[model samples]
Target: MIRWTSSRALPSVDDVILLAGFGLGLSLIVAIGAQNAFVLRQGVRREHVGVVVAVCAASDAVLYIVGGAGLGALVEAHPGFVTAARWAGAVVVIAYGALAARRALRGGEELVAATDGAVPDAGRRLRPVLLTALALTWLNPHVYLDTVVLQGALAASYGDDRWWFTAGAVLSSVVWFVALGYGARSAAPLLRRPGAWRVVDGVIALVMVAVAVSLVAGA
Candidate 1:
C-alpha cells in the first residue's frame, strides 16, 4: 500500500515523488532537439499541429509505462542493443542535421516561401508529416535513455509509489507538448521574416549535430 498523507508543515512522500517525476520529465523533454524543432515548424505553419502534439505526448506516455514496467532492466541486460541503437540514432540525427543545414544555407526567403506554400496544402500532406513526426520521436536514442533507462531507474527507487511517479511524468509530457504546439502560433509574426527562419533552422541544425556527436562519442 502507498500513503499520500502529509503533516501540517511537510509534503507527503508521495507528493515529493510526484513532483520529482514531473520535474525530471520536464527537464528532459523541454530541451531543444530534433523532435521539438519538427513540432515547432509544424505548429508555426499551422499544419497538422494537433496530430504532431498527440503523437509526441502519446509516445511519451507509452515510453513512460514501458520504463515503469522494467524495460530499462531489459535494455541494461543487452549491451549490444544499446550500441546498435546509439549508432543508428546518431546516423539518423546527423542526416537530419545535414538537411537542416542545407536549408539554412538556402537563405530565409526560400524557407518562408516553402512554409507559406506548405500551409495551403497542409491537408494533403498530413500523412507524410505524421510519418516524419513519428520517425523523429522513435528514432532518437536520447528518448530511450531519458524516458526509459533514467526515468525507470528513478521510478523503481520509489517502490510502491512508482505508478504515481509515472503518472506525473506523463502529465508533464502532455503539458509540454500542448504548450509547445499550440503556443507556437504567437510567434508567427516574427517567423514570417526570412532572416528569423534562417536563424531558427541554423540553430536547429547545430543542436542536431551537437546531439549526434555526443551520442557517437558516448557510444
Candidate 2:
C-alpha cells in the first residue's frame, strides 16, 4: 500500500466544522414532534408528501441562515418572542389533534369515499397543506430554540467558518426531510386498510396532544 499520510490528507478545519454542524443539526432534528408527526402522516397518505418535505427543508435552510447570521442571539434576548410562539403553537397543535382524532374515528373509505362512485381526489387541498406545513415549521417554538438559538450559537462559535457550518446544516436538513417524507412510502403496504389509517391518525393525534402539553409546560 502506498503511504499517503500527510496534513493535507487529514480533514481541514473547515471540513471538521462542516461535519460538526451537520452532526449537531441532525441530532437536534431527528427528534419526533408534532411537525414530524404531520409529515409522516402526509407521507403515509401519499398526499402532498413532496410539498411537506420541500417546506420543511426550505424553512430549515432559511432559519439556519438567519441563525448563522446572528438572529439566534437576538432571539435569546427577546424571550417574549418564544413565549408568544409557544402559545400560538399550542393552540394550533391542539386544533390539528382534534382533526386527527376525527379522522381516526372516521374510516378510510369514508374519508375520501365518493358519493357518486366517481373518482375524487380525497386528499386535502393544496392551499391548506401549504399553510399547515408553513405553520408547523414556523409557529413551533422548538424550531426557534433549536435551529435559531442553539444552532446559531454553535455556528457563531466557528467565527470565520460559520457559513461552512451553515451549509452543512442546510444539507443535513434537506437530507433528513427527504428521507423522512419519501422513506415513509416503504410503509404504504401496511397502511392500505381503513384500520391502519385509523391507527395512524390515532397515533398522530396523541403525538400532537403531547406536543401541545409540552409547549404549554415549557412556556
Candidate 3:
C-alpha cells in the first residue's frame, strides 16, 4: 500500500503545493487530443460551447478527486493495471490519430464553421453534442492514466496536502477548458480556411501519435 505523510506535518494549506498542482495540471491538460479538438470545434461553431466545457471540466474534476482521494494508491499497488491501461490507451490514441490524419488529408473542405451567430441548420443537436463530449472525455483511457493514476500518485507525494493539490488541479482544468472552448472563437476566422483546418488536423494527428508512442515506451 502507498503510505501518505501525517497531517501533523502539514499546515492548513500550502501555497507551494497549490502552485505545483496548478502548473502540473495545466501542463498535462493542455496537450492536444480528441477532447481538445472537439471542444475547439464546438467553440468555433458556437454551438453549445458552454455545455461542452462544463461537461469536460466536471468530468476532469471527478477523475482528479478519485485519483487524489485514494485511487492513486490502488493504482500504485497494481502494476498490472497500469500496464493494461497503457497498452489500451496506446491503441485508442493510435486509432484516433489515424482518423485525424485521414481527415487532414481528405476532409478539410468540410471544416468551415457557421460564421453567423445563428447555429447552422445542419448543426448537431444539443443532446448529441453533449453525449459526444462525454464520450470523448470518458472513453479516452489516457484520461484515467493522467488523472487517476499519475495525478493521484503525484498528489500522494504531497502527504496531507493532497486535497489541496487536487483543488489546484481542478482549477487548472476549469481554466483550461473554459479558455480553449471560448478562446477558440477568435481563431474561427482563420480556421474557416480549409488549409488552416488541415494543418490543425495534421498537428492533432501528430500529437496523438506522439502521446501514444510515449505511453508505449513508458510502459
Q: Report the lDDT tens digits of candidate 3 across residue range 1-219.
A: 999987675443477667657755765676556787778777777788889999999999999999887844654676455566557756766776787688779854432434435343336689999899999989999899889876776566555567887898899999989987888778657655777757766776776677567557756
Q: Show how many residue pairs clash in every candidate, following the order shown.
A: 0, 0, 0
Candidate 1, poorest ten consecutive residues by summed lDDT: 109-118
For candidate 1, the per-residue lDDT at 64 reads 94
User: What is the TM-score (0 to 1) of candidate 1?
Assistant: 0.61
Candidates ranked by TM-score: 1, 3, 2
Question: On residues 90-203, what C-alpha lDDT tens digit does candidate 2 reach at each position?
Answer: 676577678778878885622222112222233679999889999999999989987886667556545556788788889989998888677755644453456876776777
Clash pairs detected, candidate 2: none
lDDT at position 135, candidate 1: 94
- TM-score against truth, every candidate: 0.61, 0.60, 0.60
lDDT for residue 196 in candidate 2, whole number 0-100 = 75
Model 3: runs farther than 4 Å from truth?
1-13, 71-123, 188-219
lDDT of all predictions: 0.71, 0.70, 0.74
Q: Point to the candidate with the largest lDDT.
A: 3
Model 1: per-residue Cα lDDT over 8-85, one tens digit each: 777887786686677667656755577876777787777888999999999999999998878435445654555555
Q: Candidate 2 — which residues are off by over 4 angstroms?
A: 1-8, 71-123, 187-219
Minimal lDDT window, size 10, model 2: 110-119
